[model samples]
Target: MVERVTLITGAAAGIGVELARVFSSNGHRLALVDRRGDRLTTLASEIVAAGGTAPILICCDLEHPEACDDIAAALAVEGVEVEFVVNNAGFGLFGYATELDRAEQLGILAVNIVALTDLSLRFSESMIRHRGGILNLGSLAGFLPGPGMAVYYASKAYVLSFSEALRQELAPLGVRVTALCPGSVSSEFQARAGIEPGLEHEILNVSASDVAYAGYRGLMQNKRVVLPGLGIKIVPLLLRLFPRGFILAAIGRIQLRKRR
Candidate 1:
């Protein structure tokens, strides 16, 4: 019989790394995917050192259109079945949408939207068979518009929407889907997005470990959405109190201010 495993994309760093640790520590065998083979190797060693199962590492970039299919093939060849999926590989470019390189912006959609959606749907069949779960890493930015990182925010909105709908559709089949929407996480994401650590980031920021813990706990509990931190949990309620135009302009200014 194929071994059942938790497959995590972007497992090389940030919350991805923490998620791997949490799941592995809980005795879940992992199939870790990332473009960085070296980092994946180091992580796999660390997991094994800590008395966890050695993870199956797949060093493939999710930006490729056939990436999800490739992942499934790789897992099959390893004689493993994906019982849980974590769609954590995503990036953002910080700038006005029009001013940023169009190709780069589209790459954002490629990974954040296309790849995430594809992987979720692809392994969902196996998850249903195994009565397993999926944990998608969304963002607090998904709740509102992002002016500087337009494509990134839009992509996360799609993640939030898609995860919610997928959750409902998969629940009856014994497949749990939970979107982990965190606020500013202290990770490589901000630096990659070219977002400077501002007051808002400081106020809202939570450690990747905390977010990972919340995600793991929530998924096991079959929660539809897991928003880590008090600050993150308050964001949606606060958004409800604001006018759309005001919220839009305010978020735009904040994002623009984070430039450089």
Candidate 2:
């Protein structure tokens, strides 16, 4: 039997790295992609040292438009047939929209929205042909308005909606799709987002390992959406049930408190 290859973006650390560990432990060959080449190389070495196969480390920034094509071409050259693709490369920004730099906002969109969506489409086409799987990392913030982190929240919302629709469209082709929605997670996300560290501790936070495990399980089950934390599981449903105005007001209040 041919060894299965799983391509995971942002695989140098956080949830992405945990997902790589999970797949590697299960005997799948990995193609770990991340912008942090040094970290990716260290992780690959550790995996190999631990007796699991070391992954192919692709250290290219996915935020660029040409990244998807470049990765696809590189994989072809390496003779790695991707049986699974996890679009997990993302970051968050926190601040009032007006206070944020336009270029920074656009950069966030390029990585969190454009890259993810384009990669999913490009990889899904191949997956459909091979009857493989795709897992997208969304966020609990996707369910409702996030006042300070507007663009990041909106990007995640797109991910959730896109993953669900794609799952439906690809069902007949045996190409499974899953969207993993996680709330506050113990990672460098808070620092990267410029979120107050104190605020993170106040919320129900799950470990990256927990999020990765749940995401992998849900992906294997072909679930359309998977919320990692129990407290966050009801957020999507509640957002759908409540009025949008009410949700916005609540989020605004929370943001105001955080800014204080």
- RMSD of every candidate to native, in Å, equals 0.9, 1.7
Off by over 4 Å in 1: none
Global fold similarity of model 2 (TM-score) = 0.94
Residues 129-220, candidate 1, lDDT per residue (tens digit)?
A: 99999999999888999888889989999999999999989988999999999988888987888767789878888899999999999999
Residue 122's C-alpha lDDT in candidate 1? 83
10 residues in a row with least lDDT, candidate 1: 251-260
**lDDT score, candidate 1:** 0.92
**Candidate 2 lDDT trough over 10 residues, lowest sum:** 195-204
RMSD of 1: 0.9
- Sequence-dependent TM-score of model 1: 0.98
lDDT (Cα atoms) of all candidates against the true structure: 0.92, 0.86
Pairs of colliding residues, candidate 1: none
